[model samples]
Target: MLLGVIGDDFTGSSDIANNLKKAGMSVGMYSGVPDNKIKLNKYNAVVIALKTRTIPIKKAISESIKALEWLKSKKCKKIIFKYCSTFDSTKKGNIGPVIDAIMKNLNVDFTIACPSFPDAGRILYQGHMFVNGVPLNESGMENHPLTPMTDHNLVRWLNYQTKGKVDLINSLTIKEGAKSIKKRITELKKSNVKYAITDTLDNQDFDLICSGTDNLKFLTGGSGIALGLPKVFKKKGMLKKSNSKLPNVKGNTIILSGSCSLTTNEQVELYKKSNPSLFISPEELIKNKNYHNEIIEWILRNSKKRPLIYSTTLPKKVSLYQKKFGSNISSKIENLFQKIIKNIYKYNFNKIVCAGGETSGAIVKALMIKELQIGEEISAGVPVMWEPEKNIKITLKSGNFGQKDFFSRALKKL
Candidate 1:
């Protein structure tokens, strides 16, 4: 593979894979670290999606390194450590620790840390992350059930988890273009900075960041960092125009959402107005071992209407449930969705739309889907993925991605 990417979660994996595909690179997305026997030579890039975003630090580091080693073995020219544009993580993170581990494994001291995706309303300025013109801490991300982003300053947030020094490369220098950014990187390295959080304001800034880091062995950021990478390879005569088509997938569709993000909550409400929707309560999920069966029956009865089975409640209810059942309530809900997907797929439901990172990760792993062909995008940072052998097409949407009509819009695209 020409490029290899390690994503911290399934939704973000599909997000980056979608960007690469749109940029004219054939991309394959995997649910987890693939077996060594699987062939990967046909694609320009391969994304190994791991459910490590909210995981314990040690396990996240271990899994990320294993994925890194596998990619290195494939002779990948460059590696990207992809994370969410929201800079989603706790004070003790899988992001910083995983980056530290990968940097050590690669024996590289300096890399960039940018989580700016302008199209998705995520931008960075002065080393602090913003969502929709609001600081990250003030954004709805601060109430994220799992990895609440209470800090907006990337330098301070990442520094808490990494042993190495973390610094910033502000937008003022970036506006001077790639050469200026490169010069700043050299200065930071001389000062022994291990990671530099680059500030980005718009889509054009992505080009500058990619050009400046073009020669680095590894790059770390959100999907936006990938916007300029395929062109870099093409300039070196390493790219080809590969097919980015999808099989016309027609079948019974289902919407499964487990996100409590503000956007997803709005999407769920908008979708519920016209579709057959069933809300999965966390209390019932923990109390009823056979809860999935009821959900399956409802889906079957409402199959023609494209049923939506969601655990997407308001933040207060989510907090109440978490307080009553502990933090694992989200995990329990995700497992419930997994059971629903596994059961419903047997009934000829081939087109699946999943919302939320953890929910998408659980369902894909349960299905044992090893590889996916990247297809047409449904929205910015969201695309329809095809598992041709299984005759299934899926679109994994990040909780914070897409507009109020996203759920309905995604089904039509599928």
Candidate 2:
């Protein structure tokens, strides 16, 4: 593989994979770490999708190291560690340890700390990340249930979380062009700076970043950076026109959501107006043993027009669940969604829409979907995936992406 990516979540995995596919490199997106059964020869790039974005630090580090090892075994020359555009993480981070572990294993001296996705309304300036034109702290991400991003300054946030000194590559320095940026990076490395928080406001800034970090063994950022790497690789004759193919899929459709992001909540509300919506509360998932069978029956009863099974709600309810069921309530909900997905496969639902990174990861794992053929996009940062062997099509959407009517639109296209 020319480039291997390790995404912190399934939706983020698809985000980077989408950009790589758009840039003309055939890509394979797998849920969690791939085992010996997976084949790596068909694609130039493979993204290992892991649901470790908000997990415990030790677990995250272990899983990330395993993923890095798999990518190395595939003979990948360069690797990218993909995270959310919002830079979602607590002070005790899974992000920090995961990045630290990856860099240590690769013996990488330094890597970029960029979480900017311009098209997704996420930008970084002066080493501080902004979301939808607001400082990330003012953005809805600050209210995230698991990893509330209360800090907007990427340098400070990463400095506290990472293992080494973190420095900033401000936007002004980036605008000076690739040569200047490369010189700055070299200087930082000499100063023993282990992590450099790069500032990016637009595509031009990202272009300079990709150029400056051309020789680095690792790059860390949001999915938007994937857009810049294809040009770099194409010049090296390491990429080709992506002829992604998939078999036609026609069967019942289902929408499953486990995100509590503001956007996803809005999307669930809008989709509920036209379709049968089943809400699985954390209490019902963890406390009620019969909830699974009940929800499954509900899904079967309303198989037409595609039913939606969601654990999505407002941030307040999420906090309540966390208080009542503990902080790992999200994990319980993910496990619940996986059980629902695994059981519903027998119902012949071929086209599935999974919203939220954790939910997408769970669905893919529960389905044992080893590989996917990249297909047409359902929306920005979201694409329709086709599993050839199972003849099933799935669309994975990050919590903060897509329009309010995304569910209806995706179903219409499918």
Candidate 3:
């Protein structure tokens, strides 16, 4: 494979895979670290999606290292450690620790940490992250149940979890183009800076960042960093342009939402107004053993309306649940969704549209989906993925992605 990507979550994996495929490179997005026997020679890039975003630090590091070694075994020319554009992680991070482990494994001294996806309204400026013109701390992310981003400054946030020194690459030098950005990187290295949080204001900045860091062995960023990479490989004769077609999937559609992000809440509210919607609560999931069965029956009964089974709620409710039941409340919901998905598939409700990274990860794992063919984009960072072996198509969407009418729009696309 020309490039091997390690995504921190399922939706983010599909996000970057979508970008690479749109750039005309054949991409394979695996649910997790694939077995040794799966052949990957036909694709230019492979993305290993992991559920390490909210896991324990030590386990996350170990899993990330294992993925890196597997990619190396496949003889990948380069590696991209992809995460959310919002830079989702705690002060004791899976992001910083995982990056450290990968760097140690590769023996690479310098890499860029640029999680800027302007199309999604996420940008890094002066080393601070902003979402939709609002500071990250002020964004709904501050209320995130698992990894609440209370700090807008990424350098400080990352430094809390990594051992290396972190620095910034401001927009002024980036505006001077690739040559200037390269010089700045060289200077930063000399000063013993390990990670540079790059400034990106728009999509054009992605080209300069990709060109400037062309020589590096490792890169850490959101899917947007991949926007210019296929062209770089093409210029070097490492890639050929081709069109990607979606598979013709025939089945009833169902939307499962577990994200409580502000955007997701809006989407759920808007979608439920016209669709057959069922709200699954943490209380019911925890207290009732037969809750998943009820959810499955509801979806099968309302199959023609493109039913939505959601656990999405307001931030206050999420905080209350976390406080009352501890952090495992999220896991309970995920487990419930896993059961529902496994049961629903037997009935031909195959077009699964998932919101929330954790929920999507659970569905992929429950279905034992090892590999996915990246298909056409449904939104900026989300795409329709096909599992040809099972004749199933799914759209894994990050909680904060898609428009308010995303559920309805995504169902139409599927």
Candidate 4:
């Protein structure tokens, strides 16, 4: 099977390609366009990774089909259009046209799948795999490289969920129920509902973020900055000066991120759960020699004077609502967002580092209730975040921040 990746914005395209190659797939990777053509006979599957923000709705639609036409010209039958879920926190830019282009022009026989649920299925394109809309059981692929799509089997997997559950969606007149699982986001604010969110290449929302408030009491995890970044900072060094209005490292501050299954509200619950997954460890994260406490303990012991926090943890779904949807989720999910806003004082110590635009954006959203002034994020990551929000200063960095064994060549600024 042949695989091709397009686009490089935010390091998303690379993320998918790397994941696929790790699975032992023969994948060809490229960034941007201008070359316009590839020998299709050499490959079976093609992925077009476009940054929805840079390419507007119209351009995305037109160029997406242009890509498909090029792929078809190469006699390639299977084409996958993948997009990154990340962008500036402002939520500007729309790729619906890209999806719409696929839906409208794609051959009925052509298989398509959104990159969501990356862990549940085979990533024919990246993390999970799929072919002709069918997910391959990676384990079973050795014997049956191509699994026949039986009607019943297809039906079964469509509604499949973790464990012994199925997300069956029936025709009209059938509604599902959610009686037991409860949401706790209401405590955050009015946004309690969690819904999958998408960004369109529009500047209105970003304008709102930039215009709404300033002088924000920013809060974020070290991972978003310390671990998630370092791509761009690799060259400049840790203490390099930036043009952003806000300070890169908030002195004597410690922010936590990670724990994918956790949510924003759940993050606050870190102090309550006693299990401490926000700044601590989960079952899977503790396997390393550090046991997920390397930075946490270090900070508690050695961070009495350090100004900037260099720790990280992935975000997780804390409450039931965050588990089902995500930040893009609705009021039932977002309500918990307000909790962060009102509870800002709980973390007010020195400075802040709302890392990861998404997490930082949420913090900004929460603080809006109080009229806080937030500094802007400075863009600079090597692979990821090449372009960040304008007006606001962000320290952009590549996704592989902590990967480097030593300091970067540009650390002379320190």
Candidate 5:
């Protein structure tokens, strides 16, 4: 049976996939599936791993609905499992964990707050098996029931979560943050069915919903942590504020901006033609309609064995929205983790490497994995191994570990 795992990220999905494979299972994982795109028929079962640092319940549930709709059309029996992005959200959201509660509300299969691996992106486990937060076999593994995620784990996790189901859809309980977000979202949903972050009611009251914006702006700011937004991102003024005393920059100090999701205008089209096919994937991924789904399908099609590149320039104001997203997103632990986790997962990748500290910390904290063990004994960075019944290992970093050539160097290895 083929198991599909989807996460708010790519690395976490990979870790679990690696574990499942080690446990002897056939798994296919992918992350960052654009709405209304991708075919689920390639795989039988499906899993959704919510990254607290990247995706929130508001976003995950919404995305899950879209994925479920597509899956149902493709005859996929989905068992969405809400796992941690490695941060402890109990005291933050007034809800429990983040993902599971949504599952409970959506009436999905499983939901629970699993521990996050602290290692940045290193495979930290061997011969271990965990299904539904329980050991499938004793003494054959060296890892815990729950896996942790780093900035490096997001890609792999997303891949594993969506490709298949590794265990029975079940969980013990939900965390407070999960409860809070679920409640607030539920209330909001009652008033508004669409979870999209646009509030047409008021000018200043944009929904600002989505997993990415939530973490970069709200949760990260609330923690008072100095996360550096990618330098490549060049957004405009006012839109880029900082949580610090003076400038309340949305994400860490650095941000990857100055890019657009699609091309329009002359300048955008110019860049689009220049970069024809950076990444290519299976054709089955593009079975959906619309540009959003088109992009996701394009990504899936381009992700076979090639690399998925996040453009630095072109489309003009892509960075502007990111800055807007970072500035306006709610400042709370739950919100920040939700956005960060989503960022990590939504971007599909197999082997993830990091070059930021705040990103690393956020990934570690979101998953709630304590033993990340950095410095000294940590030669190749820390890792939060979520070796479920799949075969994927996630590497993590503090976001600035690889200096400037981080993403490039990592790509070479891939």
Candidate 6:
């Protein structure tokens, strides 16, 4: 493989894979660290999707390093540790710690830290991350059920997560273009900086960041930076036109969401209007271990505009569930969704749409889906994937990525 990407979650894996495939490189996305027995064929880019975004720091570091070693075995020359564009994390993070572990395992001194995706309303400026023109702390991410981004200043946030020094390359220097940014990175390395967060305002900033870091063995950022790497690889004759086509899947469609983000709450409400929707609550989930049977029954009853099953509720109710059911409420809900998805798959629902990072990861792993063929984009940072052998079409959406009507729009895409 020319490039190996370690994504923090399943939806993130799809995001980078979608971008690389659009750049005309064949991409294969895996659910988690592949077993040694599984065969991984040569691809332009291989993304190992891991569900470590909100996990414990030590576990995240261990899993990320394992992924790094696996990618190295594939003889990948370059690696990108992809995280959310919103820089979703707590003070103790899987982001900073995983990056630190990867750098240590690879024996690299300096690497870039950028979590900017301008097209999706995520940008970093003056070393602080922003969402939709608002500082990250003020954004809805601050209220995230897990890994609330309470600090907007990435320099301070990252510093809390790692013992090494974290610095910044401001946007003013970036506007001067790639050469200037390159000079700044060289100076930072000379001063013994381990991680430097680069400020990005738009696509032009992404271009400069990519150019400045292309020679480095490791790059850490969102899927947006992966967009810039393809051009560099193409210039070096490492890319080819790929059959990244969306297969026509004809079957009953089902939309499932397990995210409690503010955006996903809005999407669930909008989708409920035109579709038969069922809300899954923690009480119902914990009380009834066979709660998925209710979901299967509901889908069978109302199969008209696709069945939408969501665990997305308001922040207050989410807090109540977490308080009442304990901290494992999220895992319980994910296990419930996994059962529901497994039961529904027996009916052969070809088109499956998942709306959260952890939820998507659980579903993919439960299905034992090892590799997926990259397909067309349903929205920014979201794509429809194809399991060629089983003839199943799946769409994985990041929690805060799509618009209000994303659920309905994604259905029309298939």
Q: State each model's C-alpha RMSD to the native.
A: 1.1, 1.6, 1.1, 20.9, 21.9, 1.6
Candidate 2 error regions (>4 Å): 282-288
Please provide, for model 2 over 57-167, each residue's C-alpha lDDT reduced to its tens digit, 9 standing for 90 to 100. Answer: 888888888899999988898999999888988887777788888888998889988889888889998888888899999988889877898999989998889879999
Query: Is 3 or 4 the stronger prediction by TM-score?
Result: 3
Please provide TM-scores, in order, for all candidate models, with all chains considered together: 0.98, 0.96, 0.98, 0.30, 0.31, 0.96
Candidate 4 local lDDT, residue 28: 36
TM-score of model 1 (CA atoms)? 0.98
Model 6 residue runs over 4 Å out of place are: 35-42
- Candidate that scores best on lDDT: 3
Steric clash pairs (candidate 6) = none
lDDT for each residue of candidate 5 in 1-414, tens digit (9 for 90 to 100): 222334443333334433333222333343333234544333333433334333454664566555444544444322333222232122222123334333444454422222322222111122122322433222111121112222222223332333222221111111122344345444544553222111111111111111122222111111001011111121211123222111111111111111121111222233344333331111222332332344444545544433333222222232353354443321222233334334444453323333222233344444433221111111222222322222222344322122233433333332
lDDT of 1 by residue, 138-200 (tens): 998888878888989999999998989999999999999889999999999999999999999
Cα misplacement distance, residue 244 of candidate 1 (Å): 3.1
Give the Å error, residue 178, model 6: 2.4
> Model 6 shows how many backbone clashes?
0
Residue 324 alpha-carbon offset, candidate 3, angstroms: 3.0
Off by over 4 Å in 4: 1-10, 34-49, 85-93, 109-113, 117-414
Better of 3 and 5 by TM-score: 3
- Clash count per candidate: 0, 0, 0, 78, 139, 0
Q: What local distance difference test score does each model get?
A: 0.90, 0.87, 0.90, 0.29, 0.29, 0.86
Model 5 lDDT, full chain set:
0.29
lDDT of model 1 at residue 234? 84
Runs of candidate 5 exceeding 4 Å displacement: 1-4, 34-57, 72-78, 88-90, 94-101, 105-113, 116-412
**Better structure of 2 and 3 per TM-score:** 3
